[model samples]
Target: MTDTYDVVVNGASVAGCAAAVLYARRGAKVALLERRSDINAHKVLCTHYIQPCGYPVLAELGLIGELEEAGAVRNSAQYWTRWGWIRPEDRVGPGVLPHGYNVRREVLDPMLRRLAASTKGVDLLLGHTVNELLTDDGRVVGVAGTAGGERFEVRATLVVGADGKDSAIAKLAGTPSETSPNNRFSYFAHFRGLPRPEGHSAKAYYLEPDNAYVMPNDDDITVISVLPSMERLGEFKADLEGAYRRFVKALPDAPDIDAAERVTKITGTVNYPLVVRESTGPGYALVGDAALTSDPLAAVGCAWAMQSAHWLADTTAPAVLGHGDLGAALNNYRKRRAENLKAHAHLIADYATARPFNHIERFTFSAAARDSRMAEHFHVFGSRLMSVPDFLSPWAVARCSMVNGRALLRPRAQPVHSGERVLTGQGAR
Candidate 1:
């Protein structure tokens, strides 16, 4: 027997589940397919900080409270460059939305899938993997695949490729994608009893050609991630624990190793590149890493997944509900995703090269550290609330340039702090 739905979403992970839920809530019948037969299947390797942009969707899904109840950490970011710790603002106070959530994907993913499964108009298809696109006259009409080792077909008006970076839907449908080479190796593991960095829920250390993160997560466990230059891969592969610990422990003011206990095996990825896929194709749309994959330094992956799903669903839901043109809706989805993520993705790609910060980057970082307004703008930009271009305006650049230029002219005034902790979140100390 064949089943049909308004939308058949591939990969019932974060992005796919979000798309399925949104579509179902809009009264469109949706089928969510997941290849994982285990009900508790979840992602193991992720930075796990959902950016501020994801809050609205979590609220819409009514899962924010559930997340909090599950011990999700409220997060803010403090950055450490050669200049100093570019601190967050004085207040981590509540805003239109809570700051953000820091929870492991192991906890977050299943919760998201449950929401999709329980939604009224959504059918959850577990243990299903798409093998071929069922097309008609050049338009994708549905998909045929195996579910629980049995062959089956499902027809849908629109297909969504929310599969991870390597999307089967994109491959089968011939979705055009551009790939940017990433020159870093990343590994992360959980630890308990580590002292918190401060009021900020997460902190990043930026060493030229390498970076590391300390993320406070649920159950009092902290996740420490390190990304080193590709040339250093052998060192990591040789003694991963030694390399990972050496990379993170050497950072200034890091956690007390004497007190913390390594709670999990070191896990990581080496070859995930920056991929920008054509977001919309004939009779279909893509979201999450499938549509656009960014550098993980900014920790935007998780939230981008949820946000892209929201964008696709909001833009295409009208058409799926018979109130708008499908082509126009798909176009809107493509445009919106590009409009929001293009500038951000460009900056990430640049940073992904694992090179030292140039002069302009130093100026920007120092100015943001020295000034509250720039710091606020940086916060919004890093939170994915503002675009990179918007965050670095020409006027703001001129002001920063002047300040940095003056400092350069005077020997006593160094615009960038070399080793001092210039920012402490409250103010420069």
Candidate 2:
């Protein structure tokens, strides 16, 4: 069978579905193909935390209402560093989404799939896998693949590779790529009745070379994840659950896991290669993990996936709609993507090496823990709401220096009485 459309998108996950919905809403006919046979299938190996920067995209797609209806939790971010807890004051700059959402992929994925399938001008093709690109004189025209064991062809003006980190479309197109090794491994599980984090916010423990997270999500479920450097892999391997539980129980203001019932088996990953690829080609483009895969520690995968889809559509739609030159538009999209993510990606890659905080990182993080203003700047930058240059502005640097210097020079508190004992442990009794 043969079909035609304005755009044919491969891999109907977060990026693919967003691309389909956005493109179709713009009046482009789109065929969204997914190899998965089950429409309700969800990604299991994900933290599923969307940063605040991505909330606007969800609102633009009109999914925020449904997401909230499905019990998505709005969450701010707080960090526990050696110096102290760095919790930003809830401050929203003009036009900035102040908080992020915690929606399990089980709910988020199927919700988006259903949305894309039902949208006008979008043909959601389940059980269809693109096996080959249909090219005309070195330019991609569409794709050829099988749908439910039957050969199918889709001829379109543009093609998108939203597949994933291991994107078949990217491999077939031979996108230039580079990968960096992750020096850490992670384990996570969901629990019911876990005590709410303070202010119901997301808590991250920057335990030097190791890290942990407590993310409260929909349906009163909370996700606790531990990411330890590869040096501790042996300890984790000896007893995964034991080590995982011990790590979680040791966090500052740790959740009441002993009282909470674990509802899911432990899920762990040993290696996650950070991938960066050229996002555009002659008649093809990539978004989401297909274009760039950062360390999971950054927790920006889901957000960046949707944002990249937004970028792709906003920058290239006019050209795809025949109002402008396509090549120039694709180049424009590439530039926009780099301008937004290149520095951030570099920072994430460097941190993924499992190194302890450098002098500047320690100075800034400690200062943030002490000063709410600096904490807000740290939070805003960490949330991916601002650029690296903006976060490290001269004014901000000067302020951080002053804050850290004050914290360092402050006199140590003297005991009220000689018999007074200072408690030195994490969490409450």
Candidate 3:
């Protein structure tokens, strides 16, 4: 069998579906292929925290309303460090910084697939696996593979690889990729009745070489994740359940895990290497994890996927519609990917080393915990809304320094400890 489209996207998860829906909505015929026959299957190892940068794209796709209607929790973040808590001034209403959503991928993935399948010009082909790129004179023009135990081919003006970090399309297309090792491993699961530190707020603990998150999700469910350095693997391997519970239960301002019921089996990602692939070539492009899979600790995967899809569609759909230059459109898409993500990837990769916080991080974190304005800035930057240069301006640094100076002159106060050292497993402080 054979099919033709203006764009053919491989992998119908977040990125592929977003691209297909957006492209078809823009008047281009698209074919979205997924290897998994089960449309409802979700990524088991994801935390599914969508950042603010993804809100506009989600809204544009008309997914935000549906997500909210499905009980997605709108949230901001609060961080706990040794200095104290960094709480940004709570802002009410829309258009605020550090705002995002927490909807489980079980709901989100199927929703995206259905949206793409129902879009006017998309053919959602589940159970289709691409085995090789169909090339025309040195440029990828389509794909050949198997579907339902039969050979098939899909031809298109553009080919997209959204198959994730282990993208078969990317490999078949020979896309150059670079990888950085992660020094930590992650484990997380959903629980019911876990107490929240505040209403609909996500919490993070920066415990030097280890970190943990309490992300509130829809339907009164909460996700608790711990990312401890690789050296602690033996502890987790010996007894993952007990160590996981004890670790989270010991954090400062920790949630009441004892009061909660474990609703899901634990999921862990122990070898998630930071991967960056060349975003575009000839007649092909990449989005989501196929393009870049940074440290999951930043929770940028889902957001970056949708936003990159938006970038790809916004830049290249005109060309697909015969209204612009294809080569130039491809160039613009490449530029967008780099300009938006390169710096963020650098920071995420650096932190993936699981090293202790650097001097500047300590200085800024201390000041942010002391001052609301600094906290807001820190949150904004951490949310990836502000560039590193802008966040570390001389004015910002001077103000943070002032905040720290004022704190040093104040009388010493009793230290805040949860009951024990969670990371080092030391006795009560």
Candidate 4:
């Protein structure tokens, strides 16, 4: 059987949904395909934190009100470094936009999928898996798929590959993806009744060499994640619950996660490498994880996906509606994404190797932990309010250096067992 649309998107996750919805809203008929039987499904192994940069897109899509109504919490970020806790600076002035949202993918993903399905020009096909790209000459024209043991084809003027980190469409389209050595594994779960830190914000506690993040979502539920290097995965996986508890307990301002009721089983992913791929080619484009995926420590995935969708829609709408060339539009999309995120990617890629922070990072974080003004700047940086270079201005670096230098000078006390190490023995943390 054959069907037709103006654009066919071969994934129904947030990125794909965003593309479909935006295209549909622009008056193009869109077909959104997903392999999952449940259109409301979400990626279970995600942190689900939306950065501030994604707010404009959500507001533009008219989803802000709905998301908040659905119990999404507005929050800032706190960094728990070994030096001390770096909370947002209150003196930076009031009336600033809140940093980001700590949401559960279980809730946000379904909401987004439903919104896309409800758009006027969208045809959402769930439980259908794309088997190959249907090309005319050398240009991608549509997709072939299977649903209910039957073959089907969807022909369109353009095809979008938003099938995520392991995108088959991207591979079929001849787009090469490069994998980096992320050798990091993460264990996460939801808990209730754990005392949230005194402030209403998400916290990233840097246990250097390892890290833990406590993100407060809607209701009393919080998402706590531990990211340990691959070499340490065995120690963590051997006794997941115990290791998790120990990690939480070691936090500077430790939370009572152990005392709290376990609301979900400990879930983990092993050796998840970060992947980035070229996002555009003739008659085709990619969005979200299909284009790029980095470590989740930054919590920018959802926001980047939503924002990229909006960008892709704007760039492609003109061409799809007869105002520009589809190939040129896709090329433009690639340029835009690269210009916006390349530096960010470079920084993350470097950090993932667990390299010791340069003098600048150490200074900035330490200063932020000492001064609210600096902390606010750090928060803005964390929330994507500023770019990396801009956030690391000469003045900012100097201030951080001065403050950190003083702290370094005042530090005293030598450890009696400086080289002592804790060995993992098939037990929890």
Would you list the rank order by lDDT, best first? 3, 2, 1, 4
Badly placed stretches (over 4 Å) of model 3 are 90-98, 413-429
Q: Which stretches of model 1 miss by more than 4 angstroms?
A: 91-98, 402-429
Residue-by-residue lDDT tens digits, candidate 4, 1-429: 899899999889888988899999899999999999896688988887889888888887788888888878777777888678887845644336455577888888888889988899999999889988898889888899899999999999889988888888988888978888775678888988877654457778776667778888887788889887767777776887788788778777776775888788989787677888988877888899888988887778888898789889998888997888888888888888887888888788778886666776777888998877788888877776678888889878877887777877974553343246533433212
Candidate 3: tens digits of C-alpha lDDT, residues 50-130: 998888889998987899899998878889999888887554322355577999999999999999988899999999999
lDDT, residue 335, candidate 1: 93
Q: Compare the candidates by TM-score and give the number of the best one.
A: 2
Q: For model 4, where is the 10-residue window of minimal lDDT?
A: 420-429
Clashes of each: 0, 0, 0, 4
In model 2, residue pairs whose N, Cα or C atoms come closer than 3 Å (at least 3 residues apart or on different chains), thus clashing, are none
Report RMSD (Å) for each prediction in the order shown: 4.3, 3.0, 4.4, 5.8
Off by over 4 Å in 2: 90-97, 414-429
Candidate 1, residue 83: Cα displacement in angstroms equals 1.0
Q: Could you estimate the TM-score for every candidate?
A: 0.92, 0.95, 0.94, 0.92
Candidate 3 collision pairs: none
